[model samples]
Target: MPIKASTGAAYARVEGIGAAIPSRVVDNHEMTQFIETSDEWIQQRTGIVERRWAAEDETVESLSLEAARNALAHAGVEASDIDAVIVSTVSHLIQTPSLAAIVAAKLGTDGAAAFDIAAACAGFSYGLAQADSLVRSGAARRVLVIGAETLSRITDTSDRATAFLFADGAGAAVVGPSDVPSMGPVVWGSDGDQAHVINMNRTWPEAVESGLPSQLTMQGQAVFRWATGFIADAARRTLDAAGLAPEELDLFVPHQANNRITDSMLRHLKLPDTVTVGRTIRHFGNNSAASIPIALDAMIASGEAKSGDTCLIIGFGAGLVYAGQVITIP
Candidate 1:
């Protein structure tokens, strides 16, 4: 049986958001050494200027731990208060022990249940929805959701499309209870039918065992097609679910996938540039799941978002998935 709409779920609000970027910076000019694309062409398409790269010694566990610590401090919550830790990622350094488990151990919160969620770029959004549910169900009071990835580790510098598009970064957000519905119902969907549109299969054990090149690859145009229509649909559904209208929004924080895709979705949704916050992918490339929250943190700090301000966070990619939620600052 399907759950009916209009159930009175408890309100779940975001307490804080923190982001971490590796100290290493890789700029566009450096791409000339490996790929045929020029800095200008890449920038015109993806809006990436400089992206962070993990040090060779960096591990997914360490990055998530650092990001989680910053978010916990900003929210004034102790690690012990967290009921669970959810990690969203596609680029963990290893395949076992679950990155979330390792993150909990690092934060001294191992008593909390932890798990990993793989929804590709929509990972953080997926994690947020799960966290919200946990809180509303009285199962958890506080949840830590971190989207961390070292995409550069699997990127083939020779693959022009991927080499210039992916980088490394992490973002964490703490979700807890609040008076009003600070975060709205999320509209999410996945079409495994298009699974190959954005693939990361090279790193599979069998592929590695067979001595095949381990790298990340994507069908840029195919993903662009999915992003444009699916994201617009997600935004519309989220607004409708919240019983809100577009004109009431203060900002829109979208996954920093590509400049062209964002522009297309905005056009399709009839939203003006003023309502959207651009992390300027030209500045950080695509951090995948971390992109939306990274942009949200920037919007809040810049005063584009404030207490009582309403906004939307939408992300889509590599699950062949899309998710959108209307969030209000409290």
Candidate 2:
């Protein structure tokens, strides 16, 4: 027998979602001066057109706080109503106090059990599970989870392969109790086996405060192979865990890692083109943790989803990690 909500007896639901990107935009063609790659090569290889770059003053804390405010406002939930804050990122510039704690203080959401969780690009989905769990266990009434990154900070301008694909941004969502299971059980997995295939350590500064010197390095082809197969497997397992099938889903929100990766995963799942929220990171570049939630905000604002619509959110990133959740809108 599962425990029920205090004032309510029901499952958890996503009340609202919001995303914030920096004002500065970087396009691939502009990479000619910074790297050896051509605009045509970038376009054909990665479906990215442009991405936002953070200004010197724009820190991850600021970006996450802005996203949190928007998510709280959109959800119509008071700051005091939030019981926890989880920030997912690998680019959290600081080493202590936790980025979530700082954002909570800025938002005036005091006393909340704030913390951070890093799963690389799959961070948001991983955090979503944490937030959703908080609601389900009756441990909290509302939880604020944010996925933020500043990949530009560590990107080696000389390394064309990495400098062009990684950028900065943040996105957030609020979860609370619902009248029914508004979201499906998340299915997640890890392949500690494939971790080293995509790593960055060959930069001028050698390395940074933590692992990999903050710069993203990867063998594009190797990642492409791992991504397509891994994501498809996660998707199938997620839908099955939710007790649903591919055709039953109304919308599929996948991590905006790469257009090719997204397409390949979708094809393997046998899902049609109309089911995806694709090409976000392609244009915005891989904002790492922020990718999926940013697309979620866009999908909702565009009215692409409606009441009772089933939306599947999936994320894949470092740790060779991947996860997905099935959600229903109110």
Candidate 3:
């Protein structure tokens, strides 16, 4: 259930932000060494020219830890001050212990309630909503929300549909109680019937029996149709929930799934020239759950956005799940 907005209660604001992308860069031209596609083909379709791939030693845990540290430093908070930790990802190598638990341990956040959410690309927004509820309800004073993924590890390089789309990276935010309102109510849901449009072809057990790699499989056309067909209204509802008009927004940080999807959303929402759109996909590809925060961080770091700016963030992905909300940059 959505938490009702309260003027008399404490709310959550993003006090710190950080992002950690892999060192290696894989450009479209370099991809041709292994795949049959060319740079022109990918650019015209996805607007992605390059993406980062995690090195052999880098794992979800490592990336998340670094991002978390950077966020703590930015927030000027110690690890021990965190009351909870939440991580969102679909590409963690191990399914057990939860990526949140591993990250908490690395940060020395002993006994902090920790867990993971698997809402695909919408995971980060989902986490933010949960953190806001916790803070408003007095269940937690501060929450660490991290979206880290290593899609490259599970991507099938030979699969032309997805090879150029998935990449590796992590982004994080420190959510804490604030005197003024910053985060907005969440608008989120899913359509399971359309799950097949983008998903892994085989379950782990099925992959074992079939002797096939447990790689990501996508139906690009179907996903594009679905995204362009649905996400705009969803974004409008998110803005409405915050009592703000489209023209009032300063930034639009939709999930960095594809440039075309982002452009279609811009057209549908009819955002004014004043609203800065996030274009992280051109270089970062789609980092799934991590895309929104990475884009948010990049925007702040580059001076495209700053304190007190109202931003609308949207996340949509596999399970056909999606979530969006309005927030003020910190």
The per-model lDDT (C-alpha) reads 0.81, 0.81, 0.91
Candidate 3 weakest ten by summed lDDT: 4-13
Between prediction 1 and prediction 3, the one with superior lDDT is 3
TM-score of each: 0.93, 0.92, 0.96
- TM-score: the better of candidates 1 and 2: 1
The window of 10 residues in a row where model 2 has the poorest summed lDDT is 203-212
Write the residue-wise lDDT of candidate 3 on 1-330 in tens digits: 999753323778898988998888999999998689999999988899999989999988899998889888988999999989999999986889898987898899967999999999999999999989888888888899999999998899988788899999999999998888898899999999998887887888998999997888888888898889888789988999999998899999999999999999999898999999999999999999999988998999999989889999999999999999998898
> Residue 314 CA error for candidate 1 (Å)?
1.0
lDDT rank order? 3, 2, 1
Which is the leading candidate under TM-score? 3
Candidate 2, residues 1-330: lDDT per residue as tens digits? 998645432678888788888878889878777999887787777788888889888989889988888888889988889999999998886778899988887798858989999799889989989888888777888999999998888778789667778889999999888877788888888888878766655543555434455556777777788888867778878888888877888888788878888777777777755564545776678898899888777777778866678888888877788878998753
lDDT against true structure, model 2:
0.81
Q: Pull out the clashing pairs in model 2.
A: 48-282, 208-213
For model 3, state the Cα shift of residue 318 in Å: 0.2
Candidate 2 vs. true structure, TM-score: 0.92
lDDT of 1 by residue, 160-251 (tens): 67888897888899998886778888899999998888886665677768987667779888888777776777777887888877777777
Those runs of model 1 whose alpha carbons end farther than 4 Å from true positions after fitting are 1-9, 203-205
CA RMSD, predictions in order? 3.4, 3.3, 3.2
